[model samples]
Target: MAKPQIYDVLHREHEEVSELFHQLEEAKGAEALELFARLKQKLVPHSRAEEAVVYPRLLEESNTADTTREGIEEHKQVDKLLAELDAMTPDNEVWQAKIKVLADMVGHHVDEEEGELFPRAKQVVSDQEAEQLVDEYARERDSFVEDIRLEQRDAAE
Candidate 1:
């Protein structure tokens, strides 16, 4: 089998998060909170894994450095938004507004990653390096997700 490209792996995650955000926007009360938890669970790890496996490589390339730095900063902003949502109940007056803002912010981030970052990354790495990065990204992300799942499970219990 051909090794999966980093673009496809990241894009699949983007779609999953986008779908969760859609579900979250339509949900109310506890359901919204539940959806938000899932989004946080998925997103935090995905961003971390990208930073671990993707960003550093791009940061090393003068051609890709600025965009990679911007993407990293955007991830930090997204982290803050996730934290703010986590602190509030879904029924809070501002919860819905915050969710909309997060969705828009994420949508913009995805556009930049897909349109600019990925194309530039493609130029910076060889086909072999791209494939290797996909493997590394998947492993790193899955490990983080499992750790988060255990924490959530322990908290619930």
Candidate 2:
């Protein structure tokens, strides 16, 4: 099957995350925890894929490099927030507020990626190259997810 464009793939992930955040906000108890876990699973790999597979191309253009650089720093902030979220229980008094902050951070990141970065990236990267990157990013993201699953499985055992 023909892979999607890089923007399409990443944009779809962004949508999923947005939905997850809404669901997370509504949930409580173990359900909230499970939803958060799922969000983390999608998030970490998605960010890593963009960093490894997409950022280099975005960085090639001076116009887009600053935007991409900021996006990378934003990703780091999200990771740090995710780690903090991971360490807290669902019922903790600060938990919901933290989730909101994470969601806001992700929302900002997605807005910039879809609005600013994707347009400039399309100008810099060819349709064929973007198509190729979709596959590479999918592979990279899948590998990261599997590695995380393995680590969790091992920890459980």
Candidate 3:
């Protein structure tokens, strides 16, 4: 079988995140909190790794730079919503509304990324580079997840 490219990895993650958010919508109390935690674990690292490995490459090329910048800004917006959600308990009345907004923002970003940025990236990045990015992004994302796990473990101690 051929190795997966960057988009393939990202697409899988996107689908997972979307599903988590969808599940969260119907969840309550502890279930909602659990879903939110899972979403954060997947999303934060994915964004950071993409910023590290994918966005920088896309930003270098004229065709993709603008779209990449837009994507980064969308990340910032999503992060802000996430932070707000984190501050409040899942039972808070505002939590559902805020999560809906976050989901919409993420959905829009994913649409643009898959529709625009990936196509532009294909135009500029060679197949070899795309494959290399898949590895690099996974490594970076894994490192972030490990750091989070360690931090959580320490906090519990």
Model 1 CA deviation exceeding 4 Å by range: none
Candidate 1 lDDT over residue span 24-89, tens digit each = 999999889889988988999999999998999999998889999999999999999989988999
Clashing residue pairs in candidate 3 (N, C-alpha, C atoms within 3 angstroms): none
Model 2 lDDT per residue over 3-48, tens place? 5899999989999999999999999999999999999899999999
Question: Each candidate: RMSD to true structure?
Answer: 1.1, 1.2, 0.8
lDDT of 3 by residue, 101-126 (tens): 99999999999999999998999898
All candidates in order of lDDT, best leading: 3, 2, 1
**TM-scores, one per candidate:** 0.96, 0.97, 0.97
**Which portions of model 2 show Cα errors greater than 4 Å?**
1-3
Rank by TM-score, highest first. 3, 2, 1
Q: How accurate is candidate 2 locally (lDDT)?
A: 0.93
- TM-score winner between 2 and 3, please give it: 3
